[model samples]
Target: MDNLQLIKSQQSKYDEIIEYLKQDNSYWLDNDIWNVEDKVFGEVEYKISAKNIRFDFIKNEVLKNEVKFYLVYSLKNKYLRLSKVLNEHQFAIKYVVEYVSKCLLNKTSFNEIHIDNNKWKLFLINNGISLNKNNQIHNTTYRGICSEISSFIRDFYDDREETEKDIWYSKNIKGAKIPATGVHGVNGHINFMSIPIYYRNTVKKYFKNIITKKSWNHCHQIISHLNYFFTKFYSNGYTDGFIENLLRNDIENYLYWLGNDYKDKNPTYRCKFVSYVRTFLEYIQMAQYDKAPKKEVSFLIFQDDIPKRELNKDEVKKVKFVPEPILKQLDNNIMDLDRPQYIPIYILLRETGWRGTDILNLRYDNCLDPIWNNKEQKYNYYLCGEITKTGIAELKIPIRDKVAEMVQKSIDKAKDLSTEENNPKKYLFNTYEGKLKGKPLNKQSLLNTIKRLIEQKDIRDVNDELYHFRLHSLRHTRAKEYVEQGMGISIIQQILGHQSLQMTVHYATVTENTLYEKWKNTENLDLFRVNTETSRLEQVDLNSDDGENLIRYEYVKKNLDAVRVPFGVCFKPSKLPCKQQMNHCLTCASFCTTVENIPEYEEEIDHVKKQIEVSERCGRELWAEKNKAYLRLLKATLERVREQKIVHKNGKSREEV
Candidate 1:
């Protein structure tokens, strides 16, 4: 059975008990040795067409019947051969059978699995795990088996008992997996049953409300934070669970302990951990439970409690973006992308700036939309998807013609491989065949594909270091594009699906085009010192920042233009008030410009041209002429910056001066 077939099912057989459950369907366990021989004889050789799996251990008639039904349901639904099903997928079905038999001996049934069952735990003891043996089964092998069984137990309640419990699985919720609520990603089993009973009942109710609205990963993260709190409480000799009554002093002590314990790590970790705990505490306290904490949890946690990144003035908050050269390399090698379908994903990511999950899980047919652009006299495309993270749904942002065409190809390919019923969600990117068939493309798989392509294509940064692409950076890069084009901050916020204006401001303002661009125009590039008295410019000692000798390189790089002004540096002392008009400082003798202003200078020229157009439209001849003159000055300054021949307000080269 081991060598005859390729065992491709990544899921634990225990999970199959939940996911492939068909309780109502017809099948009964009458015989001990359930003979399931594969009739899968095709051109695909080496696939086992015959194998006998045993299930004689089940003495109980009822439990055996249900187990058989579960297996039958799994076989019918999953694209697995009988050999693959019985194959040792880390002790696959055989181990599950052992555990099931043990449960019956312990007086447990399939319908009722107790959390306190120690015999089941004994099968997974740390020393080494297997039934009736010590150190026979390797730790890795059995641990995985335990995880699968654990998943099965957790999801069993989800699939079999959705209507019976307060908590509901996301798949069971209507519109949960729809594009409107974001991609319904992998359904990982969550074990609320494992929590201490004192906490379990309350937490289950809390989770029920959240599970319907939020994601499985978010729920998992919340539970982990809760588990940390529970472990800490029990270790500290506080046996009272979710209903524990505590004084304000006790709350303060807990906060103190949390911060003190994690003081050495990144403050953000402590901040987020505390933040998640606070959310749970507030929920319990606000719910008006009789045994809830005496202290107001919301009041206990303050605005200052969560840490903010305290960066020095010289600190460069790294803004990641795929460089233009790297982006070009990716585009050129798009054909060579490991999964050809993923090429559209990359293009949509680069073009629409949607998150990878949304793009990958798009409903193939309904994702692309067209609107007639009367001015252009053709159709403009928009990529439609939801932003579940920020609670925005069914957002349709514009895309380029080329991106739309690439997406169309992906949809066509998806249609060819699987039908709307086969791939129920009709995802544009999905596995062609396997147990994971019709499921959304794995994000990890996409990452691996990108990694392999980078190595094969020798995708490197400006300094020839191999550039590992950050997928999230594409979102930042697109925001930069929006900002560079002068899109309103609010508009960009909506497009990026940022809930807060502050979040949008951060993305829009940082706008460091890319590290490559920064490397080109900035980096350890150069610093210029201008003699204040003589107005003669020359390269300075970067190592020394003594007044009149050099300027601090870090200070200069961090602040885009000296003092954050658009036109460039001003020689005037900080205390002095400039008599010159706003932006007219460019023409003033006190203003000093440099190569650092090259990009801004170019942008200013474009702005002036637009100003000229508006002025002309209004028939304001004098205003139009003034804009034209400003445009001329901007172009002249741009030429000097490009040539590296910048000589400030005096308009003389250093040699001439």
Candidate 2:
């Protein structure tokens, strides 16, 4: 059946179940059973409805099972149909049906269901609802269902006042479709509702407006602080009265308490508490009090009183690209994958820098066939998806033939599996088996799979340091490769689907070692001369009288700032530093160059002479003069290094060797 019709059908079936369950003055599953002789005497009959067909098990004496046995048999077909329409809740339905059936059978008759109402509620609370094929129930909660069943039992079976409305602890607030009762939802909100009526209403309104997970968490934290406030100071009286006497000092004192009492807590937490509390006060002041600035009625404004902490430095540093060697290992292992299911995903991530979320949720319909590109002169394929973090929709990743081929193969695999009953046809990548079978492979699942394949035992960095293998590292690795290939920041930003250039800039971390290497090759004179066999070290006897001047010259050379430039180093002391600090270093009195560096200078002089000749031939006399002047400086430096011989500390000139 189509989805809408199927939904209607399932709802109808649930209505039937609830109707049958609530029949008679007492509800359907009440604990009151007739004797087995009732059926023989035609006093009691067991019947169930499915697909508009009624099946009576009481007449069929061949099946002498109890209430549970007949109930399961009667409803099993209906449950299967319901399960197909509702995949996520299939386990819950199956569990409830089977559980109720078992409870009925154990008592020997249908009337015993009334006696087991409390037991059933306890069962719902403890076992929580379901056992699905995918084991999703364990990752889920039944707090809402528990509260519902508890209320129902109390109102119908027991003799309790039903005046109180259900004050929900878990709900899908802030337009969230699914109820967030997981770790993100446990933000002390239920406790917050126990505060003064005025405070409770305000807090509940704020919580309902908080749409993001982060906002909800922050609200939860603020509620926790309010809890502490109610418990510590106004435990005996209504907190609303305390608000009248509240002063600026009280708020400051609370912040101070948070700082001192939770001294061991992370400083960031303290800062967040101050921030959230301040926002809460502001929210109350405007939302309820009409933006009045009265100290008595208003939440005391103390901007300085709020705790502040700087963001961690390590967290700020970005662009931690994976090393090439490690990436090579990853590629080798990934290509050798026997499953081939994960290969396309890894390659897409490694090559295209797409976030794991986008890749995991990739749809078959979003991919397009390879099209010819005049610029690239080759066919390129595209995969379109939405960026969940930024909400950038229809973001397309242009793929080369190799990556396209892998994706096409995966698409074919998905299509082949989609023909099977209940197999997913929408998601391109899905697990065919296991608890998560037929479901799109989640980010964590893909991460675990990749980690298992690559890191057999332990993942390590390029330096052999222990490293955590993350899927994000693949994106970073791709970013680094793009930067190294001279791709512009804007181009990289487009490729990575970054809305801001600032984010793209963070991924351009060129390591200090890489910077130093580039400097050595292009700018450092020491490296330039060293490459020409220039000997920076010379022999000298420490005991000789001449060695003192040698030592002084060596000290002068080591301390010079000329190592960074291309013209050569200067031998000068800071006590009597060179007057020429710029390009004039070549003509300075203390300028120095090794004999081995003479060839490079000579080659440069020859190139300049040719340039001068060409400039004169082209009738550019000014350009010729400029080249000639540069040649003169070069020739002078060469002549000085070649002929000059310094006298020793003893005043004896060295031999011309």
Candidate 3:
């Protein structure tokens, strides 16, 4: 069968069970059952048969007695149908045992009888009730009694073996199980059995005026009352806009109505009314395809507003440089408390630029020594932990020199604090040794401590919101300093451990002082000149102080053409003729005439002069100057060689020697 058919079949079986209980009251008396005396029993009577169950308003004679009683059986007896209870005289007879047990508990007179092995076993207890072998008496004071019963029934049915005939021909399966009690309901739906046991009785007691009349009547009246309230508040003139269109307006009106009109009612009573309305609406929607009003309506009903604020630069600076006086005042109060455990945390907040969450949760192992240039260097404090709100965000900041020294000192102090007995994971900033509480500071407590410091400083002005200087603002301050120092955006992003460049950019605040300095430095000409001259002098010392002095000078001057030199000679040779001639070389077609007529060294003179002319015109100042000196030396040497050659050619050199 489909799901609805299955549910209907189960409902019919429950109807049969109720009937069986009513019919065989004698069976219950024989069973020796007793309902709790103080609890209110359902006054509404039920009539049942094999096929149908119905309600009756008739007041039974037995129910009108001074000490009225009802049968209480474990829900595990699911095979006993209401039809059998209503029709079977055996079941009616069992009510005597139930009644007698209740009377005896209250010290009243009542009689009971039970059948054991086809023999009547008369029970004579305190008030004329007798306990039998098969009958189990449950004292109401036992903890989780209902839950245990429900569990027993569920297990009983779950273990039952099914036969083909039982599945195919039986009207309903015997010992049909209810859901598991408490949170784990059967079929993951609402537990009907448990619901009536707990919520129904409480609901009845609270809404006594409404529920005492009739079940369906009470349910309908409450539903209608809620419908009316919702309709008036949410509906517009054209359509009863209760289902979909009603939102904030409906919620506000409902809250006002409850607080004002129900002022005399207990707060719980008003709450139950609201809860009932919500549950009823949900049930109607689930069971009968009715729609609920928009969710925004309910959400807007009890809204709260909180103010948002951000810290400015001056306030941020105050947080950074918390004065010794303020710390001293805090120390005076916290001296009886542990202050040393917290000081390192404060120092880390200022130095490493970690947030409150990160700083509070820092561990000793998180401070790792980073390898600088593949060598063991000083420790780099890396915050290796999950962020409070976002999981697993690691921040690596180079420990500043002073901060590193402070951390080392803190570590030494921590070693003294850490006895052989303590667990190091407890916390670096814990006042005590091992536990999180009393010793190590908690997150909220740390925030409050910082806030207290801000107050004691008396630094807040009329407009200043001191509490805005959260630990996060310290990180922002560090990032802003780096940005002001002309650090690249991407580098700052890495330092702050931000996933996005945009987030890093938000921390970058350029101040007027930085802008003014940049403009002044860029515009100062004299300063630029001094720097240039110093650089040139360093170059001169590097090149000219060796055996390769002239060669180095030529090399240095060649490079120095592009460089600005404040105090240095620059030789620019004028296009005067070879100084031996009166005209520029280019204007003199007679330029080679002087060299050509010196026939003894004519060829060498021509070659040397050509090299000089070429080097000078090309702006090779150093090369041209060097070549001029070499040319004069070469001409003199060549003349001496020519004179010796002439002497040797005339045979006079032998006699002269």
Candidate 4:
């Protein structure tokens, strides 16, 4: 056994495949053919009338047997995704089988029938399967065919040495790279040979460090970035290692080439690629490792290196969400979703605005947290889940009772189907049947299912075009709704699991009407004016809207430049320029501020103190004195601003203060 290549499974493909099909007879339609019934598929759009999906095209008996074995196995286990509506999958399998039969004949068993990768390529090419990026459906079909054939050959056959030779594989790892939605994408495969042999050690060390601090998903992206980097690095035929001196021309040329190559990709893709390279360069130098670039982070990469994507008003509204009308249409037709497990997932996405991945990652045991409300005598519901993106290991955000109820239902459904091997995490949206048994529903499957619904139902947006939406658009729509509802920015920040307020701000796109209404209905403003003749501050009642107050309001708008200031607005008319410096406005008798500006006053004090220290350090004696006097004036004004709100509210006059 040790002499032979390490056995992933000792049982032959026929041993179990025949057992599952012939013995059980559940997956088999006849002795040889099979049926992928309605229950076998998810994301199905139309009526599934697929029957008699025959595999008799294979001329060789053993090869025919092998084909049935793998197909039935995959069907029973629910592993690889088949064609939509289960028709294309049939065609794919049939074509592959017919091609194999025509190419190789007279095989007693698949053990005797060894087909190399070149033959497989030739067979795919003959069927019009292309490596070109144009047709995603065709590409996906290609991926499925290769996956089924490669996996079947590798898993069942005794040709471990031969199979491993063709595609990269290790002893324990079943296969390398994940199945791409298209044939071209990869999850995690770092070809070290792609890096120059001399510089390979440095990148490997960077990866080792990365693995400890980041997920394999991140590593995959970095590997892609480096793949391009070293490809250019090698093509240049440079004598020195990996931007060793961080030459400006070298970095700029690679970036220029990268921009042209990745122009079609999301703008951030180029940014991430360059940023990742910078990180690698920094990591090597920081550790004093071999071939360290030793350059400052900004020296090689500037903020402007990555182009910013700023959508216009109409574009923002267009791309940021799927309109509610289309959403409601989707909601109504959600039960028609091909994956029944995904119904609740879709609802959660629409209602809660959580990322689809997080919704799918919801656990069965502890997903619903109901808090008892004493006054209302009801349990406030929270959907408990891990938000891995922001490193929120376990977060429970408020959910309406309906969302909670739906989550509980999904949890109940998941519990009935969970097995230790398939769903150790007990993901609520899990497959109980087929090759995906116990696995969380693929995120792509969720998206593809929705796409099927949109196309099938012909859901159109307000613009009267076919509606297309990304899953994350649901989250954005939800955030925008929250902001429009006047939900606090801080609360929205927490609900969306945003790492910073800046990200939350991006979602706070209020409609012009809402902004106007909010501005107009403000009943309180501690607005004040200056009695120019008397040189005293006089508070005005803005809500009164009397002739005097209206004139005062207009005056403030037209003269005072009173909309806002560093701490407060200048009560003195703009036409009369103050003799004092702008920063010294707080000391002016015309400075009128509200209680809300207290924090601003304190922050400015801190700023002034720091400046005073800097002035003293530079031996600017008179300048320091001037700052000290300004500091005194600032404190006095802060006190007066407080006194105006506090004392004036208590019915005190200016003389009393």
Ranking by lDDT: 4, 1, 2, 3
lDDT-wise, the better of 1 and 3 is 1
lDDT string, candidate 2, 28-78, tens digits: 233233222322212212332221211232332211122223233223222
Off by over 4 Å in 2: 1-197, 207-238, 241-250, 265-271, 276-321, 367-382, 394-401, 419-425, 432-438, 455-468, 479-508, 519-523, 527-657
Regions of model 1 farther than 4 Å from truth: 1-168, 175-187, 241-244, 260-264, 309-319, 371-380, 405-418, 429-434, 461-467, 484-488, 501-657
lDDT of 4 at 209: 60
- Report lDDT (CA) for all predictions: 0.61, 0.53, 0.42, 0.64
What are the per-residue Cα lDDT tens digits for candidate 3 across 1-657?
697975575455444444445533443322223231212222213543332111221123222121112213321222233334335422334333343344334422121111231122223233333354545322221222223222322322232332211111111223222111111112212112222232333323333333223232234345444544544454334243354444666556666766676676555446644655655544433443324444633354342311112344455555442233433544355423333455666667656555665666555545534435434454444434434322334556676667666666665665566643563453455455322222346555566666666566544533665534455666766676677645688987766666678667767665555567557533432222234655642222333354256445444433322211112222333442334221223123332223333563455456556555545433445445655665565565456556654222325444477
The candidate that achieves the highest lDDT relative to the unseen native structure: 4
Q: Which pairs clash inside model 1? A: none
Candidate 2 — worst ten consecutive residues by lDDT sum?
176-185
Ranked candidates (TM-score, high to low): 1, 4, 2, 3
Model 3 misses residue 104 by how many Å? 28
Q: Report the Cα lDDT for residue 455, model 3.
A: 67
Please give the lDDT score at residue 200 for candidate 3. Answer: 35
lDDT value, residue 32 of candidate 2: 30
